[model samples]
Target: MFLTVTLNAALDITYRVPRLRAHSTHRVQEVDERPGGKGVNVARVLAALGKDVTVTGFAGGATGAALRNLLAADQRERPNHARLTDAFVPISGTTRRTVAVVDASSGDTTQLNEPGPAISPAEWQAFTTAYAGLLPRTTAVALCGSLPPGVPVGAYAELVRAARAADVPVLLDTSGEALRRGIAARPDLVKPNGDELAQLTGVTVPLRAARDARRRGAAAVVASLGAEGLLAATADGAWRAAPPQTIAGNPTGAGDSAVAGLLSGLADGLDWPARLSRAVALSAATVAAPAAGEFDPSTYAAVLDRVEVAPQPHAA
Candidate 1:
């Protein structure tokens, strides 16, 4: 089973408005609430792809309860072959919420995120202990998202080492210092967007920056370039993957879906080109969906074959 860790799980609420404008009132068209947080989003995408995913994270208070309830409902709606198990640990502090306002006119999204609840030392210990127990049975683990209050700055780094010790493939998806530290632990793969990659490597160019990131110690690095698609640096080779056409929709969980595609590809022993194609297609498909953690299957199937994967000249 795939194991996903989301230390700061959230209740994702999305608002659809005719158009989002500052200092103006507009009627809301629709609202969607679901379990979120980066790892949770990845797990949802993986489970939707018929993979067995067990999600572990912190959940507490009323908001936490609601998130768990919605997570359960989502599981029930999945196909019979799909498995999504929640193994969230209880915390004293209330869980956080994230708001995504989508402009139906322009199809742009504005996000408002809350800092997660503070986790106590005891709670942190409980989580690590539980994480250790789960590692033995896990096929692969993804440590995702931001570090909430009271969690260590090097949290993902620690988890990456543990996964490595257990000989399980690990994929890290985070930003800033957490990402810097995690990369040093030498994860199997890391998915960072353009901005995050630039910040990590101090290079604005995607290819140069991705190569620099790989030097810092990731086995492979895939930099998500939004509309430009993905730039990847791996031991075998470097390649650029892009969709046939740009898709417009809610781009909220597109990155997370890309992570799912990469993780699923790793587990299936696919080659770099095949994996990059899947990642690009999944990310584009997520953009066609109305909400985070959801993808339009038809979009995914239609775009899969059309994705372009071209090799790049390796750095001398």
Candidate 2:
């Protein structure tokens, strides 16, 4: 089974409007809610792709309960496909909620995030215990997203070490100091968007930035370049994968979908080129979807074969 760790699970709420303006009232055209966090999003996508995945993290309070209920509902709704297990450790503090307002006219999203509830010392210990138990049984693991309040800054680094100690291939997707530390733990892979790459490596060039990130200790690095697609640097080689054209929709979960594709490909034993293709295709499909943590099936199928994976000239 694939394992995903979302230390700060959230109830994701999305709102759609015809257009967004400053200090103006507008009618909401649609609202969608689901269980979300970087890892939770990755797990949902992985499960949709027929992978049995388990999610472990903190959940509590009404929002947390709602996230769990929604997760269960999703599992029930898709019985014939892969399964998703909610192994979240209960906590005293309430889980957080994130709001995404989609502007239909521009196809852009405005995100409003809340700092998750502060995790106490006991809660932190409990989560670590649970994470350790899940590692041995996992096929591959993904450690994702922000650290909730009161959690140590080196949490991902610690988790990466644990996963490595258990002989599991691990992928990390985060930003800032957490990522800086986690990469040093030598995860099998790291997926960072363009902004995160720039922040981590201080280089705007995708290829150079990815290479620099790899030297920081990730076994491989995949940098998401939005419409330019994914630039991957691995020991085997380096490649750039891109969709045929720009896809328009909500791009909130595109990065997570890429993570899902990469993790699933790794579990399936795919090579770097094929894995990059899948990751790029899934990311484009997700941009065509209406909400976070989902991909447009038709788009995914249509674009999967067309994704271009070209080897870089100087991979070393």
Candidate 3:
């Protein structure tokens, strides 16, 4: 089973507008809400793909309750799919909410995110306890998203250690100081977008720079290059995976869906090339969907054959 850890849970709200103009009033055609946060997104995608997944993290206040209710609803909606294991822990602070405004004409998205609630030390302890109890059953642990206020930057590092102690591989996806500290723990995998990769490795946007990041401590690095697809470096070798072409749709949560594909592939004992293919397929499929963090299974299957994986000579 895969264990997904989200430090800051959220209710993601998305609105679709005809065209987004600065300081201009626009009529929204659609508005939707879902349980979100990076790890939760990963779990949701994995569950949709028939993987045994569990989500653990903080939830509090009315927003937290709503997020939990949404997850429960998802479970009920897909009872035949893999079940969510018990790992969600409650805390004192209310969870956060994120908003995305998508321009229908341009397919561009502007996002606003809350910093999330400040977690207490006691709440941290409760989360740690719950994580420890779940590690034994986890085949892989994915630590995702931003850290809440009052949570130390090294929190992901601590979770990495716990997963290590339980003989479980860990994947970390975050940005800024949290990512900087988390990488020091040397998690098995780290997925960062081009900008985040540049920030972490202090290199310009290039494949060589991403490879340098792997040398810095990431056992393997998967850099999401927007429409360019994924650039990956692993102990086995370096490779690039790209879809046939970019698809137009909502781009929100595509990275998280890619994480789910990566973890699911690893759990299924897929080779690096195969894993890359799955990741690329899932990411592109996500972009073809109208909802954030969701992909049509049919679209995913159709794109799987179109994903191209080629070796990088410099990756070694």
Q: What is the lDDT of candidate 3?
A: 0.89
Off by over 4 Å in 1: 18-29
Cα misplacement distance, residue 214 of candidate 3 (Å): 1.8
Taking all chains together, the TM-score of candidate 1 against the true structure is 0.96
**Cα lDDT, model 3, residue 19:** 92
* Candidate 2: 10-residue stretch with minimal lDDT: 289-298
lDDT string for model 3 (1-316, tens) is: 8899998989898889999999989888999889999999999888888888999999889999889999998899988778876367888789999989988898788999988999999889889999999999889989999999988889998999888888898999999999888888888999999999998888985588778877778899999888888999898988999999878877778899899989988889999999999999999999998677788788899999889999888643
Scored against the true structure, residue 182 in model 3 reaches a CA lDDT of 88
**Model 1 clash number:** 0
lDDT of 1 by residue, 140-190 (tens): 999999988999898888899989999999999999999999999999998
RMSD of each: 1.5, 1.5, 1.7
Cα TM-score per model? 0.96, 0.96, 0.95
Candidate 1 residue 304 Cα shift, in angstroms, is 1.4
lDDT of 2 by residue, 174-222 (tens): 9999999999989999999999999999999889999999999999999
